[model samples]
Target: MLKPVELDLSELGELAQVIPGPEPKLELSLSPIPQFGAERPRIIPVCEPSLTGNELKYVTDCIESNWISSAGHYIQAFERAFAAACQVRYGISCCSGTIALHLALAVLGLQPGDEVIIPTFTMIATAYAVTYTGARPVLVDSERETWNMDLDQVEARITPRTRAIIPVHTYGHPVDMDRLNALAERHGLWVIEDAAEAHGALYKGRPTGSLGDAAAFSFYANKIITTGEGGMLVTDNEELARLAWTLRDHAFSSERHFWHKFIGYSYRMTNLQAAVGLAQVEQMANFVAARRANAAYYTELLKDIPGLVTPPQAEWATSVYWMYGILVQDEFGLTRDELRRRLAQRGIETRTFFIPMHLQPIYYEMFKGERYPVAEDFCRRGLYLPSASSLTRQEIERVVDTLRDVRR
Candidate 1:
């Protein structure tokens, strides 16, 4: 069981005095108000999709044309548009981002017992996708600077059985793609980018998805863009694109009806989802701009706080700041959990960074408490602020003010 930590905020009185007016009350009483048309305090979600008015028109067109299923024009349009945006030759839409990763693994010709190196600090789906392809997931620790796979550790883990590398762009920060790509080229290994959180992010002016041999993107509701639930796989190779297309729909062939050309899974995306995705894609540039601006605002507001270490942007990378995360300094004498609870008490939402995969129950039983100190440290110290695209400047100010008060 996880032990709870207590937070003492008495020291914050000095900091609270800096902000104008009385500090907000840390508690509120519930009122029995009517369900409809009642004013409530604004909620700053972690993310909110930017949907322009075109979504309903496209969705209605899909429904009216009786193309709401997997085989439809909207799906093809979305695939093409996304491929063009990523600067890749082809794109395959899948039911979800996890399936996109699985398809990339399948098309890479991974076999049983082969290994794929992945960051231990990423989401569980990264490892699961490799498992689905009958390949073992070899976890590597993250670097303290960027919260991404440490290239040194990755190189150390590569062996005869290592078949590929999946470098994830954690938050909106791009991984060290040049180093990872060079390593893959040297080892003759495939590079599959897990770009789930970096749709519009760039590295040296090139898009994240275009940096690898193949890349997977998520359009889940919490992402910078949403399609309810959807994903896309992009590749520049024609053969790989054809393979992904065939494998995503159960390997059906044109010449042979009901005959399977290869073993595959049903991972097709519906037209309804694609319609929503297409609309979101059209506004991706604007959404990315807003996210970058908001990140700048937060940095300007909180840079002076001695206990907070804001997210870093590498020289070669331009992050969209999908979520504004900070590492609480040890000098602050407070744990991330303590800070999270204090912020929550002030009606501010925050989230902790992902725990290293090695610490998960299943992985822990498999690896037996092997240490990856940096990843573990990040899990304990990193906290994410509210970064919804819908957040107004006033709301962001309130959040910053609350954080400033807690730091005192």
Candidate 2:
């Protein structure tokens, strides 16, 4: 049996200032049970993929051709098309976004006892990918401006053991990649962009997947593009691309039938998944446009709400706004969770921000005394509204109206 790690309160410092006190007991019901005679509103999910393209056509072709497994024309087509969208030379399709990250790290040849810097305020998979390589993940707090890894703190965190840096473009907002890349170059480190949430986000006119040594994107149902479930790693590095393609399929030696050159993973994406992915990628531009337009509408409506902080977009970034997240300040008159509860009761779904690596139970012991003030604040006050690309103006208004009603 394992015991909990003892938290060091003194290390928390300013993080303690934003703790939001003790959490009240949560209502078990996500939404109120509909009254006997009441008509309940339809549930608006937090995110849903917009698949109004040739998804069915491609999938039907896959079935008719009997190319449903990993080896099929759709696999290469999806990889090529998506890579072109990123302005990259190659794309390696994989089972999930998590596997894409792992594949990229494995291609970089990260070894145990090495270290990789990552944003503490990102999806847990970013950290998990580094851990998968037996490399230690060094965390840095996020910057308030872009809600991205603070580049200033990155330099201080770098050490002789640092082999790479994985900067996530949090919530579709591109990070300050120019600075991050320069810093990594100065330190002689590899840079991998964890671009799972940023399908078409741009930094200085370049797409997210083209901004680093290599990048990964998720095709989960909730993402801008969906293949039911899949991911891809894109890059301009030919060697890295070839290595990843081989490793993703278990690294079978080309010279011999069953001989293995290196330990690899069975992370291949099926042709059926690739067929859907190709169709999704075909409508990538339209999906990105819809997401941006929806985000603009959400910002326009929510901007004047007191204590509500709409997501930020730096001057150099064109965020796809994957999920329209906002911070609820004390002036909102309701805690973030309370607001989420009220919205739930009205059949509107919302999701809280990432709970930071330091606060995660699986990582608690390793980062027990670590503290990231900004990440803590975000976890406390942040929650994303329904931001599906398919969301309509009426739905957005309803969600916002529910938010206003909660304050009232």
Q: Tens-digit lDDT track for model 1 on 332-364?
A: 666666776666675677777886666665455
Report the CA-based lDDT of candidate 2 relative to the real structure.
0.89
TM-score of each: 0.89, 0.92
Q: Clashing pairs in model 1?
A: 11-408, 12-408
lDDT of 2 by residue, 297-335 (tens): 999989889999999989999999999999999998998
lDDT of each: 0.82, 0.89
Instruction: Point to the candidate with the largest lDDT.
Output: 2
lDDT accuracy of residue 378 in candidate 1:
79
Let me know the TM-score candidate 1 reaches against the reference structure.
0.89
